[model samples]
Target chain A: MARPSDTKTRIQAVARELFMEQGVQNTSLKQISDRLGITKPALYYHFESREALVRSILQPLLDDLDTFTATLAPGDARRLLEDCFELMWRHREVLVMLLHDPGTMLGLDLVERVWEWRKRLTALLLGPSPSAAARIHATVAIGGMSDCVVEHASLPFEEVRAAAVAAALAALQS
Target chain B: MARPSDTKTRIQAVARELFMEQGVQNTSLKQISDRLGITKPALYYHFESREALVRSILQPLLDDLDTFTATLAPGDARRLLEDCFELMWRHREVLVMLLHDPGTMLGLDLVERVWEWRKRLTALLLGPSPSAAARIHATVAIGGMSDCVVEHASLPFEEVRAAAVAAALAALQS
Candidate 1:
C-alpha cells in the first residue's frame, strides 16, 4: 500500500489543481476523491472537511510568511516587498482564495487568521507605533499586492513579480 | 404613525449601526428589529434577509460608483481617486462590510459586484488595452485605497483622505 504521507501529498496536489481551476468555493470533496481515484471514506479520513484540507495546504505558506516577517525591520521595505511577492506568487491561487469571501468563510477563522497576520506584518513594517498616515501607507503597500497578483496572474511570472514589488514599494514610499 | 418609508430608513440606520459596531455576521435581523422596536416579520416585510438588507444599504454606493465611472477617460486618475474616496468614506462601514467575508457571504453576490466595478475602474485608469505592468499598477493603485481607509477609520477624515489619495497616486505612478 502507498504510504499515508504519500496519500496525503497526493490529496493536496489534486485538491490544489481542482481549486486553481474552479475556485475553492466550487470544488468539493467528492471531486477531489474522484480525481484521486479514492473513495469518499478515504478522503474523509485524511481531511475533516474542505476547510481542513484548505488550511493544510495554506499553513506552510503562512509559516514561510511568518519566518520572513519575524526578523524584518522597517528599513527592509524592498526585501520585504520582493520576498512577499515571491511567496505570494508561488501560491497565487490560494492567495486569490483568501482574498475572496467564500473561501475565507470556510469555517477555520480564515478571516481572523489573515487579519492577524496582516496586523503583524503591518506592525513589523511600521514599527511598534506608526502614525495614522504611516499606518495607512504600510497597510496599502502590503494589502495592494495580492489583488494585483491575481489580476495579472496570466502575465509572465517575472513581469507580474516586478510590477507588484515596484508598486508595493511606491505605496510604502508614498 | 411613522411612515413606512421612515421605518425602512430607520431599519437601514439601525442595521448599519449594529453591523459597524460588531460585524455583519454577528448582527442578527432580530437584533436589528429589537433595536428599532419592530417585529421580525416587519423587518422581513421590507427586506427578505440580512443579505437583502445589506444590498439595500450598499446599492446607492455602487450606483454612485457606476455613475462616476460611467463618464470618464484615461488621465482621470486624480478626479477618480478623489471622488471614489468620497463615495467610499461616506459608506466606509459598508465598504468594510464588502471587504470582509461574513458580510459578503450573507448570500449577496457582492464579490462579483465589486469585481465588476474594479474591472471597469481599472479599464478607465489604464485605457482599454494597457500593458501587463500598467494593469497591475492600476489594480494596485485603486485596490490600495480601501484598506488604508479602513485602518485609519478613527483619524480625522481629511488626513485619511489625503494619505489614501497620495498613496493611490504613488501606486499608479509606480
Candidate 2:
C-alpha cells in the first residue's frame, strides 16, 4: 500500500526488517542502504541519521494510533480498547524493541512518544475522575496488552490475543 | 535480622542499591565497596566481579521463590497464586529493575530463573492438558499480579494491590 516516491516509507520498511533480523543496536545505516540497493548518500538524503530514521519509522505508527483514538465513540469503550490493542499487537516488534532498550537516546525518544500516547489514551479511558480501582484497571489494561505479547511470544498468536483481551476486560470490571 | 558473617547478605543489599540507583552498566565494584565502607579487596573476597555479585544477590530471591513454589498446596490454587503475587509485590524493586533493563547479563540470568519459575508454576496451575481458554485465564492470572505493581506504580500500593486481586479473581471466573 506504500507508494514508491515515499522514500521514507521504503527506508523504514527496510530498516524494520534489519532491526527485526539483527536487532536495532546491531543494524547499521550502511547495511540498510546496501540491503535497499541504494547508495549511502541516497539513504542520507532521506534520513540525516539513524536516530532520525527510527523516529520517522515510529511517528506514523503513533500518529495512526492518535487518529484512531481521536475517532473513538465514547459509548463503545470496550471496542475502542480492543481496536487500540489490535493496532499495538500489529506493531509488536517496534513496541518490544522500544521497551527493552529504553536507555538509548533514540529508544528513550521513542518511549516518550509511546508514553505520551499512553497518557492520552489512559486519560480518555479512565477520564479525569476515575476511581482508584478504575485507575488501576486502566493502567493494567493498557500495560498488559503489549506486555502479554512480548513475554508470551512462544504461545500461539490467538492465545496471546485472547489472554490480553481477557486481562483487559477483567481489569475493567475490577 | 542481618548478622555480621552475613557476607552474602551484605553484598546483595549493596549491589541492589547500587544497581538500582546507577544502573547495572554504570555501577562499579569499587563504588559498591566504597559505599559499603569495605575495601575493594574485602569485597573481592566475597564476589569476584559485579556479574558474580548480581548472581549472588539473585540466588536467595530465587531460592525463596523455589521454596514457596515447592510448598504450594496445589489443591488450594487460588490462595497459592495470591501468596505468590504478594511475594512478587513485596520485592517489586528487583522486578522493576530487571524489567527496565533486561539486556544485562545479570538481567538475562534473572529472566531465565524467573522463566523457570513460571514454567513450574504454569504447569502446576494449568497442568499439561488445559484448554485454550483455560490456558488464557491461567496466563493472565499469573501475569496480572506483577503487571499491576510494575506497570501501575503511579497508583497507590493498596489501590493497585486490591485492583490486581480483583482482576485476578475475575479472570479465574472468566
Candidate 3:
C-alpha cells in the first residue's frame, strides 16, 4: 500500500484529472477510487465526501496564492505580477475548471472565496487609495493574464508566460 | 393589442431584463409574458421557443460585430478595437448572461458562434500569420476589455469605455 501521505497526493492527482476530463459534476468518488485501484472504503478513509476531496485538491493552490499575496511589497508589483502569471500557468487546469464551471463544479461559497481573494490581490497590486481608473486597470490586467493562460494553454509555456506578463504590465501602467 | 413588431421588441427587452436579474434558467416564458402583460399565445407568436428568443437577442450583436469587422483597414486596428469595446459595453447584459450560465442559458450553438466571432476579431487585430506572442497579446487585450466591461457594468459608461480602450491599446502596443 502507498504511504498515507503518498496516497493523499495520488488521490488528488487522479481526482483532478477525472474532474477535468468529465467535469466535476459528472465525476464521482467511485470513479476516482476505481481509477486509483482502491476500494470505496479505502477512498473514504482519506476523504469524507466529494466536497472534502475537492477542498483538499484546491487548498494547496489557494495557499500558494495566499503566500504570494502575503509577500507583496511596494515596487514589487511588476515582478510579483510576472511571478503570478507563472504560478497561474503552472496551475492552469484548476484555474480553467474554476472559470469554466464555477457554479456546478465548485459551488457558490468557494466561488465567493475566489472572488474575494482576487479583490484583495487587486487592491494589493494597486496600493492604497487607488483611483477608479487604476482599479479598473488592475482588474483588466489580471483578467488579461488569466485569459491568456486559459485560452492559450496548448502554447509553449515560456512564450505564453512572457507575453501574458508583458500584456498585464502594459494594462497596469497604461 | 400591440402591433406585432412592438410586441416582439417588448418581449426581447423584458426577457433581457429578467435574464440579467434572475438568470436565464430561472426565468420562464410564462413569467416573461406575464411581465409584458401578454398572453401565452401572443408570446409564442413572437418567439417559437426560449432558444429562439435567445438567438434573436444574440443575432443582432453578431451582425454588428460582423459589420464592424468587415470595415477594418490596415491602419484601423486601434480605432476598430475602441469601437469593439464600445459595442461590448453596450451589450454587456447579454455578455454577462452568456458568461454566467453558458451551458444551460445560451446552449452550445450560440456559444460556438460567440467563440467564432472572438476568433475572427482576434485575427483581425493581429493580422495574418502573426507570431505566437502577438496572438497572445491580442487575446489578452480583448480579454482585458471584456473583463472591464462585464465586471464594472455599474460604473459610468464613458469612464469604463475610456479606461478599457486605453488599457487595450497599451496591451496591444506592448
Candidate 4:
C-alpha cells in the first residue's frame, strides 16, 4: 500500500485532473475514488469532503504565494511581476478553473484570497500609493499574464513565460 | 400602452438590469415582466425565452464588435485595442456577469463567440502571422484591460480607459 502522504498526494493529483477535464461541479468524490481504485471511505479519510479537497489543493499555492510576497523587497517590481506570472503559469489549470467556472469557488474563500493577493501584488509593483493610472496598469498587466498563459496551453512553456513576463512588465511600466 | 418596439426595448433593458443584479440564472422571465409592469404574455411576445433574451442582449454587442473590427485599417493596432477596451467598458456590467457567473452562459453560445472575437482581435493587432511572443503579448494586453476595468468598478471611467489603452499598447509593443 502507498504511504498515507503519497495517497493524499495521489488523490489531489487525480482530483485536479478530473476537475480540469470535467469541471469541479461535475466531478465527485466517487469519481475521484473510482479513478484511483480506492474506496470512497479511503478518499474521505484523506479529504473529508469535496470542499476539503479543493482547499488542500489550493492551500499550498496560496501559502507559496504568501511566502513569495514576503521575500519581495519594496522595489523589485519587474522580478516580482515575473515571479507572479511564473506562479500562475505553473498552476494554469487551477487558475483557469477559477477564472472560467465561478461555481468552482462558490463556497470557498479562495476568491477573496486571490483578490487580496492581487492587491498586494499591485502595491508591490507600483508602491504603496500608486496613481490611478499605475494601479490600472498593474491590474491589466496581471490580467494579461493569466489570460495569455491559460489561453495558450499548447505553446512552449518557456516562450509563453518569457512573453507573458515581458508583456506584464510593459503593461506595468506603461 | 408603449409601441411594440419600445416594449421590446424596455424588456431587454429590464432583463439586463435583473441579470446584472441577481445573475442570469436567478432572473426569470416572469420576474422581468413583473418588474416592467407587463404581463408574462407581453414579455414572452418580446422575448420567446430567457435564453432568447440573453442572446438579444449579447447580439448587439457582438455586432458592434464586428463593425468596430471591420473599421480597423491594417496598422490601426492601437486604435483597435482602444475601441475594444471602450466596447468592453460600455458593457461592463454584462461583462462582469459573464466573468463572475459561469452559469450565466451555460447553453448559450456566448463563450465561443467571445473566444472567436478575441482571436480575431489578436490577429488584427498582431497581423495575420504574429510570432508566438506577439500573440502572448496581445492576449495579455487585452486581459489586463478587462481585469482592470471590471475590478475597479468605482474608478473614473476616463482614467481607466486611458490607462488600459496605454497599457495594452505597451504590452503589444514590448
Location of the lowest summed lDDT over 10 successive residues in candidate 3 chain A: A100-109
Any runs in candidate 3 off by more than 4 Å, and if so which? A3-50, A53-56, A104-108, B3-50, B53-57, B69-73, B104-108
Tell me the tens digit of each residue's lDDT in model 1 across B26-140.
5688899999998899998888876689788878777776676566456668877887677678877877765543334335555565667778777777778988788788777
DockQ of each: 0.41, 0.34, 0.46, 0.56
- Model 3 has an lDDT value of 0.77
Candidate 3 chain B TM?
Answer: 0.78
Per residue, candidate 4 scores C-alpha lDDT tens digits across B1-174 of 555578888888888887766566556778988998988888777667767788888777667766765665556777787778888988787787677556555576666667777878888787789888988888888888898768876888888888889998999999
| Root-mean-square deviation per candidate | 4.4, 5.2, 4.7, 4.2
Of candidates 4 and 1, the better by TM-score? 4
How well does candidate 1 score on lDDT at residue A56? Answer: 90
Tell me the deviation in Å of residue A94 in model 2.
1.5
Could you give candidate 3's per-residue lDDT for residues B1-174 as a string of tens digits? 555568799899999988766556557888998999988788878778777887788777677766765664545677767777888887788877656555443343555556666777777778778898898888788998899998888999989888888888888879
TM-score of 2: 0.73
**Cα misplacement distance, residue B22 of candidate 4 (Å):** 7.5
lDDT of 4: 0.79
Instruction: Give the DockQ ranking, best first.
Output: 4, 3, 1, 2
- DockQ for candidate 4: 0.56
Candidates 2 and 3 compared by TM-score, better number: 3
